[model samples]
Target: MKESLYKRIARELAQQISTGTYPPGSLFPTEMELCEIWQVSRHTMREALRELTEQGLISRRKGAGTRVCEPPTSGVNHPLSHLEDLLLLAKNNLRVIKKIDEIVADIELSQLIDCPPGSRWLHIASIREDAQNPDAPICWTDSYASTDYARLRTFIRDDPHSLISDLIETHYGIKSHEVHQTITAVGVPKKIAKILNVEPDSPGMRIVRRYRDRDGKVFETTISIHPAGRYTCSIVLKSQNSGE
Candidate 1:
């Protein structure tokens, strides 16, 4: 699911703390200033600040401004938020294709992918694994792309980490301008439970993503699943006014 606005703000702030943008013992920007900077209501800003305090990263005073108490003890983990981090991860992880087949999007698939019903898409299944230890699986992903991109699937056989967007960019001169993702907790389905090595209905994470070009046209969609205890996504929130 999309993170709550306050939670997203909190994560940004936490990230700044972890990165030393707002060093320990420093006073954070005022709540009103933060509200204006982030374009959020005061209530929302307070909630975000409250989260920082509860996490032991900040301290709140009645009259004085909020202060950074300490840096985060642990660094956030993958799936990463920054492009640099993603490229780094791709270098350390490998994508292995399992299946690639054409499928007409039904009502359910249409809703899940934000695509038109009856549209043709190539459904591709793959597993991303740690390069050093192939047995250590990162996650199982089901990717969808327009049938126009089907020929790329043939090329993927040779280059396992070949991404659909890259192929589209390479062959068709189209580039993904934006990528949106939603992460949520869910129960492992029977179909993929065996692949994930988790019991049916076991706790898992569902990450849905859509890739769009400059014209705001979506050309790719992906749904990735991972067992909860085995994988996690990390995030850091920053205060808007400080630009930390």
Candidate 2:
């Protein structure tokens, strides 16, 4: 089967991005330029750009031209990968400005946080705003921490700029030497859809992160979901030795 022209265009542009021909944080060609270069109609060019945007590769503004976004990381490179990193790569570019704390021990959550049944756990709920549009929320994150790290609460409140792991290590001397991540696709629940401004049952990606300290104890676990249209995760592989 032959692929559509729009798909071909999108794939070519994506290859450029992955190869660094169109480096991150750079401006993409104008729509008119794309139309001219591809010899396609304006509508087809727009569709190609939309595909790129939905894949989280580029951002377009009314005044500013489309801009390439930063590459997405697995949160493994840094002890604490801030939400900002993902948001910057998000199509909507949401910002998390406030964090609220609570305590919960729901049956399912207890297991996820690695605490015993009925064990007390710290919870942090945050609302993130689209960087390009402040009025809308791109997504929401609810995080849980073990009771032993309760004293680290103030660290999160005082320094919202730091990654959660960094805050934990800085305040309680618990370092996350290992991290486990799992990703899955799910339909948006009604409550989450309301918060994310998407229709109920919309497609979304759920990412679960478990952070383990130097002693191999689980300190923190977070579950975050983003609307499918809002984010993209890509990986590039390079061969170390070729043509042997």
TM-score of each: 0.64, 0.57
Assess each prediction's global lDDT (C-alpha) against the native.
0.74, 0.66
- lDDT at residue 118 of model 2 (Cα atoms): 79
Q: State residue 2's C-alpha deviation in candidate 2, in Å.
A: 48
C-alpha lDDT of candidate 2 relative to the true structure:
0.66
Candidate 1 residue lDDT tens string, 1-244? 2257887787677767655789899999899998998999999999888767766678989888789886433322443543323333344456788888999999999999998899889899988875434554667899998888768777667666646567677777777777888888999888878776668888888989898888999888889887765555655566778955
Question: What lDDT does candidate 2 reach at residue 34?
Answer: 89
Candidate 1 positional error at 27, Å: 31
Q: Record all residue pairs in model 2 with backbone atoms less than 3 Å apart, i.e. clashing.
A: 93-131
Q: Which sections of candidate 2 miss by over 4 Å?
A: 1-101, 236-244
Worst 10 residues of 2 by lDDT: 74-83
Model 2 C-alpha lDDT per residue in residues 124-168, reported as the tens digit of each score: 766555544454455566778766777656766565545566677
